[model samples]
Target: MTTFADLNLHERLTRALGELEITTPTPVQASAIPEALAGHDLRVVARTGSGKTAAFMLPMLHQLLQHSRPRTDTRALILLPTRELAQQTLKQVEALGRYTFIKAELVTGGEDFKVQAAKMRKNPEILIGTPGRLIEHLEAGNLRLQDLEMLVLDESDRMLDMGFSDDVLRLAAECRAERQTLLFSATSGGNAMEKMVASTLREPKSLMLDSVRDLNESVVQQVITADDVKHKERLVQWLLANETYDKAVVFTNTREQADRMGGVLVASNLKVFVLHGEKDQKDRKLAMDRLKAGAVKVLVATDVAARGIHVDGLDLVINFDMPRSGDEYVHRIGRTGRVGGAGTAISLIAAHEWNLMAGIQRYLRQNFEYRLIEALKGNFLGPKNLKSNGKAAGSKKKKMKKKEDAKKGKKPARKKPVAKKNSRTNKPAVPDTNSGFATVKKRKNPGSID
Candidate 1:
């Protein structure tokens, strides 16, 4: 029953939340907002669609509102990993700060650089952007954070995954040393994340609301086995044709697969669009817009859309190709079952991808629901033999041979000697060339020998 008001947020922010019909604070918001308001740097690990945007934004905005100063430099900088996420955060900022006088501007790629430079000249109090474009603005002398008060690294793990660690650290360096930082990610991004935390954050309060393995509990996960890519394609078509969902996203590991799947789905007369790294900004924006507007029910995309893109009524996620890691799988399915809403995630697994899927399941510490579509079932019914850990069993011939040898008390066989070849004739001989070096001769008696 804890509410935003009990968390001591700004009146204006509470009013904004009220207008938006969000009365209660999510677990992350309730836990994080208080610490951030107390001027502590935070490292938060929460799942996607857990109101993380509000958790950091509310505290930053509350502080900014309390200590209003007339300045021409940006006071707060929120760095995201992708343009789509930047744009989405911008909308959320506008929505949350509607009643406040604080101004925020977005500077991401896919927009005119000169225009962004012009906006930077206007001196928005809050600046939100991706790392690469923000670095450009910093180097070009178009943006400055010397007087910044707060810094938020939303989706820090994704930024690191996209190879933006250096740029992010550099931008953080540009800010004032005393600035408050809030870093959030869905997964514990292993060593790279640890390195980032060491380099960027000070003595920080760590909030782990949800672990990566237990994320998206409201979404039921199921896997359908397939024979090959062709079988997966048919499975995808069948799911889109039969599955019940308001909006669904089909994830592929590569852009080439996304493009190819988009074509395959489109040819089947399905309303589908493709989004990936290679797509132009306009196309990316258009795809998201159409998906949100209900103009398209399905979107085929790469991991680019996994972290940032948020849409209501998104209740289904299909893995056209199994994601490479457990973290990536979490983000892919995170597109659906946001907040406390219910949804379903189905992954189409091929013979080659069987072990990959099993690995992800073990990483998450949860078993997926095995399903079969009778109408278009494929030959792959999973591996005949499985290890206790759920992975496909490997060949045991070598282990059995070693056990047999131990029982018989037999010594291991030694390798045969390799044949040496003569240098001139290139034939094997008793006295062979010493790796093409001539043999040396010595005399027993140097003085008497001729």
Candidate 2:
């Protein structure tokens, strides 16, 4: 029953939230906003679609509004992993801070560098961007963060996974030494995350809103066994044809696969858009715009879209290829079932991908609902044998033989060494001190001459 007003947010921010119909603060927003308003560093671990963007943005905006500064240098910097996410955050900032006079600018790749530099000259009070392009701006002497009052690293884990650790760290180092830092991620990013937290935050308040295992409870996770790529393609086509969803996303492991799948879906007469790292920026924006406008019903993409794209009514996520890690799986399914909405996630598991799928399930500590499409069923049902941990059982013959030998108190038999042969003479070779080989020396010559 906690409202945005109860969190002591600025009147302008509360009014903006009211206009947006976001009256109640989500769990993350409720827990983080107060502490953030109190001027404490924060390291937040919340599920995706948990309103984390607003959680940090509201507090930063509230503070910025309460304290006015004459200088035009950027007071806040929000770094995201992808351009899409950066753009999304910019929209959120604009929506939430509409009533206030504070201005914000977005700096990311795939745009004119000179234009962005020109924008920097105007000195927007807030800056949002990806780390790579932002670092470039800093090096080119167009961007400065030494006077930044707040730094927010949204999707910090994904940034690390994309190998932005060095860039992020360098950016953090460039910021004001006493700036308040806020880090947000959906999954606990393990040791690397810990290291980054240590390096960036100071006496931070840790808010673990939910664990990875408990993410996306409203999403029904299921798997359909497939024989191969062709089988998966058929299954994907059938799902799109029959599934009840306003918008759906199909995730593949590689850009090549995303392109190929996009083609297949389009050929099946389904409205589809392909999004991957290789797509041009304009194409990416067009795909997203089309999806939001309902011009495209399906988006075939790589992990690039996992955390970047957000669409309402996106209630179905089809994993054409199983994600390589548990964190990636969480982000992919998170594309749907947002903000307590209901969604479905179906993964196509081929023979080669069964173990990887099983590993993800085990990592999440949850069993997926097994589903079968009777009309399009393929040869693969599942692994015949499974271990207690849900992994495919390995052959146990060798272990059984060892046990039998132990019971009989017998030492294992050793194979006799085979003699080395001289390749040229086709005769057994003898070992000597040098080079571990000595040929029969002149025996035929001795028999012929002496």
Across residues 311-429, which tens digit of lDDT does each residue of candidate 1 receive? 99999999988899999999989989889899999999888798898899899998999999999888889899999878789777976998899899997788999877758668456
Model 2 pairs whose backbones collide: none
Q: Give per-residue lDDT, candidate 2, residue 93.
A: 93
Give a tens-digit lDDT track for model 2, residues 1-450.
378778767889888988999888889988998899899999999999998998999999999999999585899999999999998889889999999999999999999999999999888999999999999999999988878999999999999999999999999999999899999999889999999999999999999998877777889999999999998998999999999999999999999999999899889998899999999889999999999999989999999999998899999999999999888999999999999999999999998888899899888889999999999988889988989877778767977998999999989989999967767668565457667565556645445554
- For candidate 1, give the lDDT of residue 391: 79
The candidate that wins on lDDT is 2
Per candidate, the number of residue pairs that clash is 0, 0
Please give me the total number of clashing residue pairs in predicted model 1: 0
Stretches of candidate 2 above 4 Å error? 396-450
Score each candidate by Cα lDDT.
Answer: 0.91, 0.92
